[model samples]
Target: MSENLGTMTDFSPDDSVMLKDVLRGLALPQKNIPSLYFYDQRGSELFDAITELPEYYPTRTEIGILERHGAEMAAALGPGVRLIELGSGSALKTELLLGRLEDPAAYVPVEISREHLLAAAARIAADFPDLEVMPVTADFTEPFDLPEPARRRVERNVAFFPGSTIGNFPRGMAADLLAATCREVGAGGAMLIGVDLVKDRATLERAYNDAAGVTAQFNLNLLVRLNRELGADFDVAAFRHQAVWDEDAARIEMRLVSTRAQRVQVAGRPFEFAAGEVLVTEYSHKYTPAVFRSLAEGAGFRVARTWTDPEGLFSVQLLEVPGAAQDSSGGT
Candidate 1:
């Protein structure tokens, strides 16, 4: 095993409290749950499969963005950056990034799953032997403290939030992530975030609702998680997968609608949803070039550079901290 950065860390109570608040939105009675919890080990493996599916274009498209801009992008980060990755699942996209970084201090992969986090950190460390690998097992949506030595050595914390995961959150949480990362990494550093761009709803819907049924399995897996962890009796098979594009909202929404009205027991409590009641599983908010930059600016990030794929399916934008100065079109 590659050595951890002389320090290993876990989430603090603050982190736990914040995560519960964000995730508890599921109980709202009108909406479905967020698919974030689908990342627990098995779900992570399923996602790895989902990335390889023919319909899932975001991963490969985002990879293309990195490949085209990787070296230039790395140079743009300035020298000797301590790269921190949020939701660092498998670190597949990030391996492309590490190729471009001019090694400085350490690499911190912050993942809620300790297993995935350590496995990825270990693999990356083997490749970048000189770069210290610090893995923090904690939820990225919540506040977390980095490993002791990792925190001490961080000169500039460059966070790589790939996978367009920002779309999963509502606008408020998205804003909070931007602000929180800025506060955590503090001023001067930058955040390279992957965002899915506004595209034809047909294309968007197909990507999430693949013919191979991997996305469906992934969506349904959340119910399995809730059942196991929360003691809920979710007859997951009784749900139908639905993907609808909300054009006005500029996002693709995934839902699990009940096939029949049924009462389900969760955490020793029972609740009923009428047939056709939708459980919103995920929302993939697609952004235009302008709206995206405005969002970062709203949350204290100065937009630096935006890289997109040749087909315009996805975007990887770099935002500077303490906010970026504005030009007529928005941050540069």
Candidate 2:
């Protein structure tokens, strides 16, 4: 563990870039906002709360898979591997993998929020004192360099992308991001990812539109973020959170619909909204094993193994590059 916990590779997007992205999205006819912006300190906290809700089954279910079969997942990766986790919020599930790994080289947690990333890295460092904890403050969806660990001889780099965060991107973008991750981890490396399986429409809809309304708050916080950071005057109360399962798209679309006709100014620019108009916030796509295997293969990875709960609500898959040896572990 590094004594200077504050030290990290910082490639975080600047405010000017964020303003540009927001403006560009607003200019589109569909009116969308990039989901990456939903991880400011407050938004991150809200999301942590969301995972605890009864309706949000992905987190707990994935954690259960990790707890039950994490050793096998680690064994499939072999030893002295440098673990890189994308969108590693709190990293509660990662501890299981780390504890089971044999003499791991280092742990790199890439996240968008600096505060949350650092706090989680500090805790991991304290608990795994012998392991190197390197935190990177950047959007994992984009290209960024991984910091080299000083103390260990790394055998390989394995990316841990959990919580079905990959579902946020459309199919094309998700494939591209996986390709980029493949490049980051190099030829012989692998990726251990959590993927949400396609299930009943009712259960999927309930997961996003929770009874506690925390998911609603999580969706609305994006506007609050824009208001505070970009000097936007958005009547947060004038909009209502909505989550609709788009059957054709096989995704849950999260949006903010205007309650009434209104105009909002962001970064000194005006945007109009009709009473029933919606501004898309995020999309969560579900996949079956075959569909996900195609998606992974398109990104240059071979599905080595997959572990799922008995109910098959979620899966934690190990995907390896061609140079790595394939494990014969069967999927549940």
Candidate 3:
């Protein structure tokens, strides 16, 4: 392993912002919480565990596609390109791409977890001795500054956003995120994103509501996080995890349903919950090929190419600036 030290910054979750969002969301008519809050250090670890579950097909399917075609994706990107990944959790799958890219300028990973970001960056630095590992910790949803080191060494930047995380955003927010990413990488830069394809409702439901109850534990961990961080009094045992496929919304909605009528206090604010009342935890939208392509075009990116497993349960799409060279690799 190389002793190269990668630079890392701490732009973690803002305490005040989190408090405001939590209170505001709890006050809503439907009572919801932003999925972003699900990623404190513990939540991040639980998510990592969720990715490895046998029922969680997105992670494995995306990795399989990349394992088979990461080289082709890098080839389409050409040489001397800076690779920046958004919400780069663990960055485990990225090694496949980094191994194939020819003379890449740098590897900039943008993440929200400071600890996780630093650890992943250090591992990447050791693994790729010659590659510049500049890890940034920031909420990728917002516009943030990149360190001088990144701006100085980057050439043509390629933003890699895998893991079907885009599904977390609704149509409008997803568009805004893509626009922000476009600005980060500049007009002539490119993007490679993983999207979960609209599949059978049973499959989608099973993926979120796993049999081992690990998913349930992961969902409940949010309460544990709130109790510790925000001084919230949540009876973890009083709530149960529920994942349902919303056909009308074309998304999987995860909620923590109150087992009984109860009152909870968070940071001195009291809230009442009725029996069976639920707090909306997450929304993961599935998309068809046409829908995703349209979204990319609207966000100012052209679909350069797409790769998918034989079953088409997921898709890894290479999107580029309009004038960028089209990759003859097409689809697989």
**C-alpha lDDT of all candidate models, in order:** 0.77, 0.90, 0.84
Candidate 3 structure, TM-score to reference: 0.94
Q: What TM-score against the true fold does each predicted structure earn?
A: 0.90, 0.96, 0.94
After superposing candidate 1 on the true structure, give the runs of residues whose Cα lies further than 4 Å from its correct spot: 4-7, 12-27, 148-153, 322-332
Best prediction by TM-score: 2
- lDDT string, candidate 1, 1-332, tens digits: 76644445777234344345334654677766656667778888889999998888999999888988999888988656777888889999888888777755667788876677777878888887777777777777776666533422445668889999999887777888888877666667789999998998788889888998988888888888777766678899999888999999888889989999998876555577789998887888888988878889998888889898888889999988863322111010
Tens digits of per-residue lDDT for model 3 on 1-332?
Answer: 34455557556668788888888889888888888877777778888999999999999999999999988998998887777888987999999999999888778788887878787888899888878787888888876666543323445778899999999998899998887676566657889999999989999999999999988988888888888889999999999999999988889999999999999998999999999998998999999999999998888888989999999999999988765433211100
Better of 2 and 3 by lDDT: 2
The candidate, 2 or 3, that scores higher on TM-score is: 2
Which candidate, 1 or 3, has the higher lDDT? 3
The deviation in Å at residue 188 for candidate 1 is: 1.0
The candidates, ranked best first by TM-score, are 2, 3, 1
Worst 10 residues of 3 by lDDT: 323-332
Query: What lDDT does model 3 reach?
Result: 0.84
